[model samples]
Target: MNSKSRVVVWSTGGVGSIAIDAIRHRPDLELVGVWVHSADKVGRDAGELAGGTALGIAATDDAEALIGLRPDCVVYAASGPERDAGAVPDYLRLLGEGINVVSTSSTSLVYPPSYFHPEWRKQLESAAEAGGASFYASGVFPGFGSDQLALLLATQSKTIRTLTVREIALNDHYPVADVMMDGMGFGRPLEFEPMLSTPGFIEMAWSAPIQLIAKALGAQVLQIRGSLDRRVTDRDLEVAFGTIAAGTCGAVCTRAAGVVDGREAIVVEHIIRMARDVAPDWKTSDSDATYQVDIDGDPDIHCSLTLGDAEGHGAGRGAMAATAMRVVNAVPYVVDAAPGLLSSLDLPITLPRNVLE
Candidate 1:
């Protein structure tokens, strides 16, 4: 703790940009480098990429160059079709270099012990141990709200029946083209199958949270079940990404539940809408995005957390900042944690009081 932790931001897309800005606001951390895959961003200033004032640091495509910097940690936020395939290699090299990593890409790593890949899990642990580093992955929905937040709310219950984490997001404000169209099938016909609708995708994406919460409650998951329901818009819908035809799919509700003690005990569900008027029958959020935890047990507790801006509107930017800060703020804890795969269960999470709205 005597010296500031030198940090590097991997990727300037999405959460990475916000991580760069969040790092600058913290006095205890230093931005050393940024890694990007795009050519146009190769020599751009870090601050410019983050949509802020100029920072002397420049973004680079060189992996070894950043590795050579010997940063205390790296915020890995690069995401794609096969997240594990693209992220694992980078994580291995970073951990092997004795540098810790806080990531938003691999959702399963939110709980290290329950990582989906058994072989890669051992390799990650070995590499981390060899280099004396740690690796943690988290995000707002698949990360904190699904696992840590649900378990946190459970502390108030003496007798537990069922635990559920619901994410109700209004996606109209989010304008990511690839995600909105191809990833979520927002503008596609009912016959189209996007990543969210692909077989085993829901379980792969969400089972970790369900199983993590199950294990914490002293039970093993006998099975994990996934379900997806998509509804079509009644009329032509205009969205930030594109248009949702009247007869095309416009909304989706996906759920993953863990069977514990011969019952469905832990569940993580997402209720997403391209427009507010698209899904009236489904659960809705007060703000643009809401993470609600429902504990159906003794002294049942229902807590609703809505992300909003200063203007009282739930904006997507606020959620992006939160996701970035989740890992950026955890850098100090990850750096001091034991050299291995750390999880929400392993490290003491910190909340910086100085973070802005």
Candidate 2:
């Protein structure tokens, strides 16, 4: 009981809330503090903010207050559009304070070697080394779906020809209007360029996983490319976020391909639909959240992973829970690892521990 790692939830937002509950359920973790952005959440119990009973761990806007607790790890889940502008400084602060940070915030940090900001990486490295702490980045899509699972599936092969990880998600139940409607351009016209369609956006958000995979396989990435294909709704469609009017985009197929040895050998493809049947021509499956990994080699292999709630619905919600737990599960490993910016490749298998019901 005395040896359990002390944990601080950096934000009680989307994944942060789930992370708190996950930490509370873990026998090896003791939740000591919660940091929230919203002023209204300042005095609320962490459990109430996480949509549960009172946990007695009140939320605070003061980051330094949380730091005063001297937690072993901080689940930095605060996220936004300006990720590079926001998450980096927070990571530096936590790492410099000798606190291990496991986050789902920055996709660039998924594999820091390929990060766009070399200078920032250097600072992060220096901070971690100075404070003797480790920083890790991971989450559902850019994380497990795009990187680890495909890399694991490749172990079944002797010689690899091509590897691909595809996310076929029915986003109808995903309630984030900003991400689905504005960011992904689901309800926007073809002329509209949503956040995901912008040039260099996909590469910025997903290239890390490609580079990670390419590096792990002893392959060099000469170029990373991105492309987008959209499907318009023939009729008005209603979704969890809102309605997609007829003639607007209802689904999208976004691909980030890593060119290795003059071929797109490593690829991360996302086929997100406003509804299950929106993109019938695509690999729309029965499940809401399904990840498909395809490897072509001496012996080909294909795998499908799905996530769902207990009631068999809200696959998106289940994905949120999974994302939180993934990083929560990694807290112990990150704390135990050598002080540096650690990637999934750096750590042993971070299995779920002491959470079995």
Candidate 3:
């Protein structure tokens, strides 16, 4: 019998927890180690840390120890909203050690060459080559479920004029405080400038998707533009993260548009809120949270995708699970790929393995 691929999961946040669950249950993969960011998490069972049953493998904050295990691949689920300075070096160290990496941390890394700084791209590529390993970044939005999937659906189009992908999420139940309050400026005063408001911020964040879609459609992007708007809460709201006082920022609407020949040929739009009633004017899906893609051309196509377990798991939780699964399912393919940075465009179809059993 073929030996299972040894894997390690980095971090234990929302997405990380899902990766751990998938790895532990997969018959073709073996959970070898887990890297934790918090000292308190050290020595705890990996499964327990991820909100599951004990898996016997203890989590550790010691990077050296985790690297020493020589895991075949690392499922990196660390946060990257503010572009954590330590992320690059950490990824380099792991890649340089010859461990293939699949991550959801840096969304831009989904198609690094297209959006990343040339110097940083070269550095990561060099590290991957030196270690004889590969690196791939992915997530539900910037990864397969949005731009990539939209492109796939566009294959039937005889001619295409424009493409737009929109994510409308009711984020009250999303538990990441930093992402909601800090990164997105949620619960802040209306005048406060959040990271997403900075000029070119949305463009930079959604560049990969824009560029990927353009490339797939064989369109030349001349420029990219960004826009942002927010709404205030009329009453105090309680969410998984914390309380949001009335008069604070409650809803956010942002867009990044890729222009081709003076037209907005491709666009990525996000409509997020702490309460459903906050942004009544903004367009939304019938479901709690939905990703919709519209292709305008010969035989225009429209697709809507909803995540979450309606039976129990909230849409927020389901979105997190989908993000994790997107990276986890790509592990084997990424491990077998040639050493270098890879994008969704380059990877073969990666489907979940041993999932039903």
The number of the candidate with the highest lDDT is 2
lDDT of 2 by residue, 107-179 (tens): 6788989888999999999999999999999887888988889888888789888899998888777677888
Error of 3 at 93 (Å): 0.7
- Quality of model 2 by C-alpha lDDT: 0.87
Off by over 4 Å in 2: 309-312
Work out the TM-score per prediction. Answer: 0.94, 0.95, 0.94
Query: How many angstroms is residue 263 displaced in model 1 relative to the true structure, after the best TM-score fit?
Result: 0.9
- Model 1 residue runs over 4 Å out of place are 176-178, 310-314, 353-357
> For candidate 1, lDDT tens digit of each residue in 1-357?
425899999999879999998888878899999999899999999999989999999899999999999999999999776888999999999999999999998988888776779899999999999999999888898877787788888888998888889998888777777887788888788788888888888887787787678777888997888999888899998888777789888898999888887898888899998877777888876578889999999979999888877443755877888888889988988898889998777777556645566
lDDT tens string, model 3, 1-357? 235789999999889998998898898899999999889999999999889999999999999998999998999988755553667888899999999999988888887768557777888889998999999888888786666789888988998788889998887877778888878988899888888887778888888889888887778887899999899999999998999999999999999999998999899998997877888989866566788899899999999888776542278778888889888988888888888999888888788788874
Span of 10 residues, lowest total lDDT, candidate 1: 348-357
Error of 3 at 184 (Å): 2.4
Best-performing candidate as measured by TM-score = 2
RMSD of each: 1.9, 1.8, 2.1
In order, candidate lDDTs are 0.86, 0.87, 0.86
Error of 1 at 129 (Å): 1.2
Error of 1 at 337 (Å): 0.4
